[model samples]
Target: MYVAVKGGEKAIANAHALLAQRGRGDAGSERIGYAQVRDQMGVLVARVMAEGSLYDPDLAAKALLQSQGDVLEAVTLMRSYRTTLPRFGVTEALDTAGLASERRVSATFKDIPGGQQLGATFDYTHRLLADELTTPELPTDPLTPPSGDDAMPRVTDLLGVDALIEPDRPDDWTDPDPADLTREPTVFPMSRAERLQALSRGDEGFLLALGYSTQRGYGNNHPFAGEVRVGEVEVEFEAPELGMAIPIGRIELTECQMVNQFVGSADQAPQFTRGYGLVFGRSERKAMSMSLVDRALRAEEFSERRVSPAQDEEFVIAHADNVQAAGFVEHLKLPHYVDFQGELVLIRQLHREFEERVAAARAEGDARAERRTKKEDSHA
Candidate 1:
């Protein structure tokens, strides 16, 4: 017997109730609080903050709890909240040169001015956990804590070893005002700012996979993480009223510098060109993936021929975000009966025409057969 599914409203209500139950888990256990989720599940929160483009740790933690630990869903929730928020003012363009760095490492040199600080990393740690985590009464200290440093020299400063690299901005270099992605529609042949803005909110898995493809000899730009730094930077904006640049607020950021070696052309000598990445919050993975992909996209500028999926800016940046890709993909499940019905009608018409042609041919054969039989009967 077919049971009619008549609980659309009731089903939604019941589903919500079930979600609440599942989120709460078994009745007597400690409920997951926002702070607990933020502090304990910081890595997950970082990912959400990176993609969501919001820096609020507490809200991101709440989203993680509400999502039941789905990172992408948590990001989506934060993004939705961000969308509804009113724009108060734009922050000043941050000077990363002045960043109060916690972790700073460069691959180009062995040891530079502001020495290596592997701050708050899971890099050297064994995957196995200690017994304390299972029965923790109080918060434990991380294996590495950030060394508070306000002034740190960039790794690029070390490149002065050779006179080949010059810190000179090209003459007549026009740095145009960046297009606001949230308010403006993205046009073809995107700017660097537009590309980075799109990628900041891009899917981690997709971007990571594309980046991996390039590293696996898909596109032959010799790439390295030249510098990767995580820290806080002051945001500054030009104030016309004050007639001077003013500090707005401090925001935490992760910056990646990928240096790709290019062969000397006839006009220029073989030099190391740069790929830059900056993202909100402490998102090293995202920032690193972004830098790799950014350099890959700039294959033309690097004078390196493009051969990989990562090199295709349109394809990579366009489809990298799950928010956009997921919405379009899942929207297929929504009601499209009208369009389906139209296709059905078109197919039926073609079938009718085909049947008519077959029927006409059969009738012609039957008539010819009858004439032959009459002639044979007359002869007999």
Candidate 2:
């Protein structure tokens, strides 16, 4: 009782053609160039790089152009392209302490070693759209660094002097490289490295919502922004031929450290717990949200009961990819006539059977009442 529909191939091809035409805009208008996207849409390219987990700005820009400014699609395109590239040796871990910082702030202390520098942020800007942006004008002044040493001591390190912050635990420096979630399947009870990797490429909006929920008392951690820094760090890789680590390139990064209040447990002393976030480019919002979610997921380690969505690692990480979520939801538009017809047939059969049963019950009741009335008449 099912019929299959066919002949979607030609339609699909035509749809794709139309999509390409629309993506390019009208023939009368000037086409958007790759250079324009790379240079002008710097923030969008940065987002693609961060979410795609790739550092190639040129390729990210190309993906942006191809996707018609759809950030998630651009990220998906970049991630797909990354799989085609040759595998290279792992890079040495970066030292944030040595970063040439463009922006650094500490909410814990008003007077840190390096005074707070609010650089290129829209936090204080008015929300209204500006008319000048329709025809943009470049800034007249050249960029200049604020007066501060490049080596700004970490706020956490300052607190460590008083033993107020948790001390760093020594670990094996030669331990095997952590599992790459991109290549390997994600297993339950993931390591901190794996968890952080997932958050680095997670959907910004999803993380933002979870972070907001935590702040709204769903899983309040009383988080304080220990430090937020944006800067460039050199990427070094070990060269077997050179017998030393060589600087490959420099990448911009945004890092956030959240200090949360923790009460003493039976085995542990009362101290502030830390949640860390580091992402590609100047992604302050994503970094802050990642830190909040990171802290929420550590509820088990802290021996706290998981009572909110933010604390559910499986749920959060599984659905954090915008690409995956969109694909699954949008797949509903595909042809499902045959499957739906089968369900329709089953539903009709069930309705018929129900009606038959009801009719039989009614007939039986009527016969019994008629028989009782005849018996009463004979008795009269």
Candidate 3:
């Protein structure tokens, strides 16, 4: 008796239903509210925003809950949702100088203007495990007042006093809206914006690993975070038709300034240069790693020693995306019988050739024995 299996479509539908049920486990239990996710799971939301390229914490939180806390999946869902939203207009270029800073620190300066504000950070927090978060009201500290003149020249700005690094000025600001990496294919010799855009949306785990390799002496390059700032930067879009720049909105941005010490070569002078990194939301590690990787990418330009994984622009940037890498890696689960069959055929053919060669050798030996026996008989 033989049996044939059918109902492929039905199987897939059933599997999807099961998955949905599993994802929304125990509907009778307290449904995870969007606010709870946004406020409590801010870290996950931050990751989603950083990777999704969307800034709405509420949407990001919803995506996280719907995707069962799978950050990459949440990001994927958020990105799909973000694309469905109409692109009415671009926002104005955000001035970092005008950012409502939550956290700001400079490693390169002793005391720069607009003193370092370590706002809302877990930097110095003890890592002791807490037994319970069941307290009715969480303890909180009063929010620090904003520093006036918000425009404290960045630490890099202070370096110019001794002619070390380039000072930040209005003239240094570049146009933002003309380049949209999401809508276009990446071009060669990428701009800083393009690189940051890529890094911002890149897979966190992959980028972290690559960044780790660089620090572990895989590239043997030294780097310091000149500054890391997390704050809300106003996004301004210029409506030339409107005859003025309009403020569309603001986004929480984490920007990193990496300063690498290098002896300048032909195209550049013997002074400190800058490597920048920016991401949506507060991802300090990602931003700092991005800065290091960014500087490492300039190995050819800076004419520095190039022995690090970060220096390999193609390898680092190409593999930095978790979504793409994950998809490709998991695609092996799909049917691959055709390729397997081809390999099987080659193996069988090789086995047959080996057997034939052995049989021929045995036959030749038998023939030689018969000829010798006849010669011995003739001699007898």
Candidate 4:
């Protein structure tokens, strides 16, 4: 036991030292700065913020540096830091219609208002990695503001005008007080707000897998990208003392609107259903995956059969958190001597019982043979 404890302590100390050395990289090379990570690796910082449920880019960058660029670790760090900060107030619902878009596109329509502005996207780039990017000189271009009208109407709204899609109902907005999952524990039959909050902070890779599963006929709902917009939107807070809303600041957002096909049910007519996704920063993949999952979770509302894991709310939300999943999975590597000893004791008892039963059966057989021999001798 002393050896086990000493060995474990020494091993952990060595592991930590190795990790620190690896995180610093080559001694001859310059160490990576948090500023460089924040500015150059904006996408990674954005991911940490989204998954961590915190919007501070600087904090996210710090977390990334501390975690050695492991996104899940960075997210955990940010989340831990977030708990120390006090809440000011909740922001009012954002108006995406008035957003100053950097990039906007729709797969369902060929041309829409504001046109398809594919801004700073990797969509057209080749998959090959360019080693030149290590110390590359970037080209400087004049900032060209988006031309035409700034108002980009939602594709779903256009469909709604033609009665091709379900109209946005007032009942959807009837939830006065939404549950805060951070403070309160998640209960069964979660509200839409709670589900969205969970998904926004969920691990992107897990959501991507589940979303892909839906596309592969698991919970097939022919979904199309109605609209994907990435841009800056104004955030406003309503103060009770002021009795009015006040603009706080602007935040970059990625919003996705997915139109899913739904057949006519007994209570409702056939119409295109909607799945919404909104997240911090420019995350198209995450937004799209989130929308697919959002629709899948609403199978009951659509009167569709829940035949897939995506439709299982308990499974999806419970396992969506990487921190929680990692803790439970990694805990297996810890000491389990007591647990194993209990199992060992039970196995020995079972083995002994089996041997005793075998010995008793053999003795009984010998006695029967002896009795048969005695009867034969008496007859002779």
Ranking by lDDT: 4, 2, 1, 3
What digit string (tens of lDDT, one per residue) describes model 1 on residues 274-347?
A: 66788877788878888888878877765667777898888987898787877788788666777999999999
Q: Report the lDDT tens digits of candidate 4 across residue range 22-122.
A: 99898999988888988998888889999999998899999999899888889989889999999987888888877777888899999886678777788
Each candidate's number of clashing pairs is: 2, 0, 9, 0
lDDT of every predicted structure (CA atoms): 0.78, 0.85, 0.77, 0.87
Best by TM-score: 2
Cα-based lDDT at residue 62, candidate 1? 92
Among all candidates shown, the one with the greatest lDDT: 4
lDDT of candidate 3 over 1-380, digit per residue (tens): 01122557777777779988998789898777989998887767888988888889999998988888888788889888888888767765566755667888888776777777877777897978889866355359754635665456677766777988644433568665667767888676776667767877888777777677767777644667788988877776778789788777777888888876766678766777777778888788888878777767767755667776677766776788777787789788777777999999999999999999999999999999999999999999
- Across residues 1-380, which tens digit of lDDT does each residue of candidate 2 receive? 11233445666677689989989888999988888888877767888998898998889889998998899889989989989988877899898876677888888999887677777677787989876767446579945445444447888888778867665443443455867888999898887778989999999999999998998987847899999989889999999899999999999899998988888689978888888899988899999999999999989988998999999899989999888888889788767877999999999999999999999999999999999999999999
Q: Where does candidate 4 have its weakest 10-residue lDDT segment?
A: 142-151
By TM-score rank, best first, the candidates go 2, 4, 3, 1
- Model 3: lowest-lDDT 10 consecutive positions: 1-10
Every model's TM-score: 0.81, 0.88, 0.83, 0.87
